[model samples]
Target: MERLHKLFIYRKKLVRPYIEQLLKWMDIITYVMSALLIMTLVYEHGFLISFQEIGVINRLYHIVWVVFLVDTTLHLLLNYSDTRRKYRGLAWLLSVMLYLTLIPVVFHEPEIQGGIHTFWAFFNSRLYHVILLTLLSLLQLSNGIVRLLGRRTNPSLIFASSFLIFILIGAALLMLPRATYHGISFIDALFTATSATCVTGLVSVDVSSTFTPEGLFIIIMLIQIGGLGVMTLTSFFAMFFMGNTSLYNQLVVRDMVSSQSLSSLLSTLLYILGFTLAIEAAGMGIIFLGIHGTMDMTVREELAFSAFHSISAFCNAGFSTLPGNLGNEMVMHGHNTIYITISFLIILGGIGFPILVNLYETVTYEVKRIWHHYIKGNKRMRRKIHLYNLNTRIVLIMTAILLIVGTVVIVVLEWNNAFAGMSPTDKWVQAFFNATCPRTAGFSSVGMTTFSMQTLLLMVILMMIGGGTQSTAGGVKVNVFAVVMLNLRAILIGADKVTIFNRELSHDSIRRSNATLILYLLVVFAGIFSLSLLEPQASIMALVFECTSALSTVGSSLDLTPTLGSDSKLIIIILMFVGRVGVLTLMSSIIKQKKITKYRYPSDNIIIN
Candidate 1:
């Protein structure tokens, strides 16, 4: 090792500048390759490329592949130690794959060529090239994005812009010839893309009839991207693959993911992604089991349906491949388990990532304790106290209260109304499902038209008071609502402090909560008022419901979605964007905030009834 190190030092002194110069050129070339690769993918996927076009595309892919092949090889041969430590396994695996692409070309003997044929078919296929190129493109693009993060830019702006970029990309992809059936207009495509990207389920067109499997796949991909904030996915990929990012970059990611410490930034991101995929995978299985052999769908169709809905539900996107959504007769009748399972998945997703992390910590601690006490024969066990954080406790309590109350109320109100023909089990399941959905899960067990005015109003309220903070859910988050209510209680009791669970809320929290509620109300009211003018034919009640649903990022509608004017759709699109990105976040990005002053002005009390 010492001898090799000395030799490396000698070689570094001999040609260090050349190696450094090569690395710089490789960076620019890799970025160009990423851009070219994406354009090629879009060209191939978006249009029906002819044989000649395919050949051209394949040649382009080969060029990109060779570029990466050379890039990876140079890094390995020159800076192997640095690459190993920083890029870690990802760089090594990519290097191996890059070399493997040459196998079919290198091994030309007839006997050996027989085995290489299979290798050629796979490693040289368009699909393989697509995957490989996509990975490399993302890596390159993400590095650029991470570099941007290291700069002193407004994170909120970047956050909003990331979603915007995806929405536009998705809109463009959906406009592709093969993505939809017959065709689609740009406005409708934008609406669907915005809806999917925002995880807001309102569709101007029927997803089942209008979109092909490719389109649906695009929608689901958008949902997943939107479910996890766009910046989050990019940051995780960049950090997880590249490793040891700038402190500023780490801080930005830590803030985005709500990591408690710098050390746990990577782990927090992993937990978020890991928990999402695991839950969706598990939910997919549960859904498949519940609707198995009953939907008349083949196993492949069932699995696809299950995976799509599982992701949509967990993302709170509420997109459904079926025409009537979860209300489809095939799955809505006896498949109560699917409804219940979806409801729980929604809850789990909307419960917030911070709470998930907290729960994970609690679970891990308990498992270790039990393992030590029982398995290791240790008698002394640490007492479990305050396992839940203040935020977790507040959210869990509020969520439980909302779910239980909403379910009971819906059952009582909708028993002989919308759910008249259903059995007791179905009623409870449907009620819970509806109650769960308005909190940001878009799935519905019954048509919106069948619901009573009172039920609709209840749903509107539930939509306003959405799920937890930093969750896939939208609307005025439950955390803010809890804080506002606590503040209200404090005022009612003539107390200055908002206290709960032996913890007094910060003044800033109270102020922000009030601001958030007021902003949400303004946005919802403005949307409803504007929609009423633009969609004069729509009933006031329907307009109100539509406005609330759109602004809350809840996918439910009063059968008025398809009939809305283009102008009204644009309004809803804006609301969905605002709701998902957050009114405060948008405002923060747009409206420059003044630095905090060292002195405070005189304060006065306002007159109130």
Candidate 2:
């Protein structure tokens, strides 16, 4: 027994490194196979396939399946102890599924078959192929994402690079002939892909009319991934599946989710994913019910529409299935419930995940405390109520203020102009939506071109202010805006320190806010100037609006995106990318931040503006 135990321990030690190496290679192969599989599927869908072509495709799929079967088997066998401990029965179930695939491949007897034949038939079905391919593709994608995020030294660069890779892949997928009804140009596809991946809704082509269902699916996927952020999504999967989140990964995620401590990083990510899925699912259901028996489309189409719009709104992507966008009569006529639901989704999405998490924690703690006090007469529990962090307080207060002020401003300005044709209730609803939409949701219930110049200018300011930091919404961020305001107030009051909620703001925070504002303005102005030179015939106001929209990732346009020249489109694309990633993050990724020196240089005060 002692000899056998020693041999088993030695075997485990020898196989561990081999297993790790095999897993690494498997990830690389899976990445390659995923790309190839997507290409094959796209090709098959795009072109009419002959029997020979179909046979080739089937053979390719079989090879991939065989590779997966072998890899999964080895992985299970080598890591049996760890897998059993981590995943319990799930590990065994996965192993079974992998092994079952081999049965269909080995037993090819056409004459002598009963239950086996039925099983083989089901396994060979198209639905099975799709399910298997999709699962493999997701697994491969998640693996790639996890590997990319494991970079501890330069997380920002890795994060940016991942999005760029996704953009390229999405462009390639969209450039396939079958992706669009009419084949799109590479540049146009790249633009659309970037826009979708950035969750910015600036489209070069009419999405509804140009893209096929496959194209729509790709766009939606990009939006969802982009909205949640590539790093956050990948880390979530890494924690759930691999369960090997290193301390470095935890620290990086701690920064991303704005968690107070490294210990809560995993839980914070789970909250983000769970909250997003829950909200989006609820929005989808509400939208489906609201539009049910109202639209002329079939149930499937309605469900698809609901799902698409729900995701778009929640992600703040602003991509719409309807050609006319939200201005379409199906929504604007009497679907007030749908409009309200969409607006709420936008609001929730705009509120950063951190803020939501904070709120959830706070409410949960309060509820528990209340329950304890009422049921158990625990007075100590009631007194232990936790206060929200400063970031959460500022974000919530500023967001509410902006929403209310924006709504009132828009209602007052457009009541007799844009709201002239609507009833009082509809007018208020539209006003509220228009206000909220400018804060990065970008959906429009009315024609933007029809809005007066004053209203457009107001929208530009609101867009510039943007939604919360670390949110799907883009722009300067509400936190920065609030900080700037507080700093200005301090200066005006002749105070020695800039403070908010009785907490002193740091000099670094103030400096970053100032730098962000200056850099944002510079970019916007530069874009406007360049666009003016490129599209000389376009109105200056329209050019400014376009620049602001691009820089803010607002997706709202004054009928200018499609009409712009290649140079203008490229500029807008760059702006959208920078906007979504944040000017600071992009700069940080490119410019190596110098470490602080203990010895300080002489300081001097500069002349004030």
Candidate 3:
């Protein structure tokens, strides 16, 4: 009778965890909860190692998770001694429990008369082995968060932190009375949050049917916050409240959003926010006016839809409440006017904050100063209030070139392919929108799956180039692209210095640009390779296009994201984070700095082709 009672108590405990409902580091708590769920599954399914069994493969993955977790925990404890000390009592107990649980594997006996490795013996252990591994992934996440917190000035880190926080908030919102549904899992919530925060348009469920207006609004909020960056908003408020700015904060904003200088950092942020709101609000009004006359929705619904799409369009965030993703319904209903308006928003939003600021200042000042001179002031006495920097010039010039080139190339390539059946005007419009949107803005009037390989490749290139610096768009950056072009031109001309607009480029700037380019390419390749391993049957171009889109935060996909398994989705998430924050920032945060030396190293030249 006592044994039966004890068993009942233990079984009850199995279903319900003993941990209290604490919201300290909620993200870490959720992550740990997920790992525990995986552990429970392993414990339920006893170890049955066989090469052909999918269960065995999955079990091994869990085991690997364990080992990885341990290494991560040890590193965290060693590096973050302060945290360890603060939780010394719990740390000591956890340390002892950790080793004790691994003792069986550590001292396991080998099978007699067989040449089995000792490590393989540990692998054959029961499913309870995951307990140790669960702690490892948790530790890794914790350590990463701690390290990120240390580099608070980094723009990428600020964006990443915001993405994480918004995701948690979005998840909580979905779990409320309105958002929950039969098929919605917490994992799905997390995935959706990641997609919105990263501005990747991969949807696992039918977004229109599955999410309610409240839920959809949460998503739109995440996309808008994620698109402009959380820090960008916070920084604006900080400047507003303090009525004074610090150089340190300026540096933070500059690094966070890729700004050019400290002089107009606050103004730049204000302009970005103001410009974004104005454009999106205008877009919503335009769409509402254009569609309310004929659309099926009620007045409230129309207003809601207009507002949601306006934010999404300006943010380059491709989430839609309509099914099939902005299909021919809008066009057939004569709401094509909204499409053109959205295209304008996308183009303007994709132009980097720096370019936008410089353009505004230059044009506004030039016009005012010219008028002043014509109104009886000496023309020679006129002084320009705004000066365009090299970075600004490069971004503006390259952006114009890219927009024209991308439009022309897309039109030419799709002329005989996807655009074959459309009328001349519609074809041109579709091609133009496609050319602009895929670079960062993810809205699509045409089906991505129907595009030819050439068109897809062209999109991949455009997405990879992305938008301008410090803008809502992602990519290696237009300034970097411009610098590379200049460097190539210099090489071809046998010049020692790369100069543009009669001004010589700084070596440091060139080096940083080169580093950014190389790192971005490497990260993209890594994503491609990882995805390929998980999805062997997927096409190379499809994979490349998908990878590029995710890496550039351009949400266009060839109907691949929804079909990808958990592992593939995880890889995509990592790439999206990297792409949005930028590869160079991530690399700088990870790479340990070396000590400076007084002596200069000898220089040498290597032979080239």
Candidate 4:
């Protein structure tokens, strides 16, 4: 040990440079290898590995193991003390774990050799290999994400790029034979991937019939990731577990997650993750209870069905494992509880992360205050009048207004027409669900074609209006809609400033809201025009609904999605991508914004009306 230490220390100047150079090359090699490794696993998942392919898979895994071993060794040798101190010697321990992957290679004893053979058997087991493959790949993926963010890339561009990457990856994964019932075309795969990643429920093919359980899992995974921005999951896991990331990386993540300051970044991430899982779990349970013993499904099937819909509804992705979605006969008629539960889940998810965080804080404060003042009989209790934030207040109000108006309108117009056969209680439940879904949960219980023309118009408006900003749901967002309405109200009422809840709305906020509204309309119109040209056989109203749905990331369709041509599908794909990542966000990412000029143009107003 002393001689080894002396050798490394004595030759530090002579050997350190080469070691450093080797480490750089190894890092590049590791990047390439890690990507290949993941692709290999994906390929294995897509198809049944042949007897011949098994050997090849083993060789590839062994190669990866060797690379990891070398990398870990060099990292330890280069800065032994630093690594030992870092993460409380976690790196050194993981290196030990890596070394254990060679146990089978080290011990070649037969079964009769007792303890040595038993050890060999354990290490040589397929389960160990599988676990190692998964563990290493995840670590690599997390590390790669950290490294990518470490480079000073524009956050918006990174945001767009990451979604594209996931879409492509999902597309490839979906195409795997094992993922699907038979097989699907690349175009269909791409469309499905884009839809899933964008949390838009639109599908060219029926998800229930087209995909195997494996494929559905992949789609759900994409929904979860897409529902939460890509940067969010990667950054949280990488930084929290790995530790010692660059400060710039943390700051970038801080902005992405809407943390008020660096100090609160961790809590914000935790809250976002906690809210997502907890709500989804609760939704799943409620859905399960509502549909229990009704679907002729097994225990496992019931749970899967519940979990899938819960995630889908909360993500507002609109995808459903059921053939006709929530409209399927099993639960559509009398399982009114299911409809109400799903609608509430969609509302919660669409309300935005900021609001969720604000609600959490408010709830916790109230709980603590109540406990201290009432339970503990304390004389003093902390209080805050402005517990709810401005954004939160606006979103809640707009969401409430939209839901009530949508419900009332749908019920008044469709009470006798579309919902003829349903009981009075059932009619109200269906009406409420239908109204709530248009704000964009894509789970349709009633056929779109059966709706009155007036109701369809209302849906179009609601779809375009969409859900809240920084939430899984998409569209112009409730925030922008509220802002624009307030601005208009201010103008009509002869007030210079738009005031709400005793707070004045900023001019910048009004300007941004107007810009978002205009941009959204322009994009939706462009999509409609393109689709009309590509699909001349389709009705103008259907084209309008399709474009609105795609652009708004609302999965509702007028039975027009399956019939669209390839070109039309591509157009919808672009719209879904744009809608999922905000139109403003995509434009800001691509088009460079010139720095603000010191001088401003003379103020002027253009004639209107």
Query: Using alpha carbons, what is the TM-score of model 4?
Result: 0.93
* Residues 3-79 of candidate 1: C-alpha lDDT, one tens digit per residue: 99999999879898899899879978999989889978887887887999989988888899888888888887888
Give the Cα lDDT of each candidate.
0.90, 0.85, 0.71, 0.87
Cα TM-score per model: 0.94, 0.91, 0.71, 0.93
Comparison by TM-score, 2 against 3, better one: 2
Q: What are the per-residue Cα lDDT tens digits for candidate 4 across 513-559?
A: 99999999999999988888889899999999998999889899999
Candidate 1: lDDT of 310? Answer: 94
Candidate 3: count of backbone clashes, pairs at least 3 residues apart or interchain: 3
Model 3 / residue 358 / CA error / Å = 1.3
Between candidates 1 and 2, the one scoring higher on TM-score is 1
Please write out the lDDT profile of model 2 over residues 1-609, one tens digit for every residue.
Answer: 999999999998988898899877875787788778877877887676899999999898877777777666666677766555544243345456656666666777456678767888876676676567656666557656665556656877877888888899899889877788979988899899989989888898999999998889989999999999988887776566555556677777778878779777768888999999999999999999999988898999998999999999999999999978999987888888888899899989998998999889889887887889998888775454336888889999998999899899889988999889789999899988898998887787799988888889999999999999999999899999999999999999999899976799999999999999989999999999999899999999999888888889889999999998888889998998889888888889999889988998899999997
For residues 127-228, what per-residue lDDT tens digits would candidate 3 score against the true structure? 435554454344434443333434554445455666667677666555555664444776667778777887766676778888876678778878888877
Which pairs clash inside model 3? 66-133, 69-136, 155-256
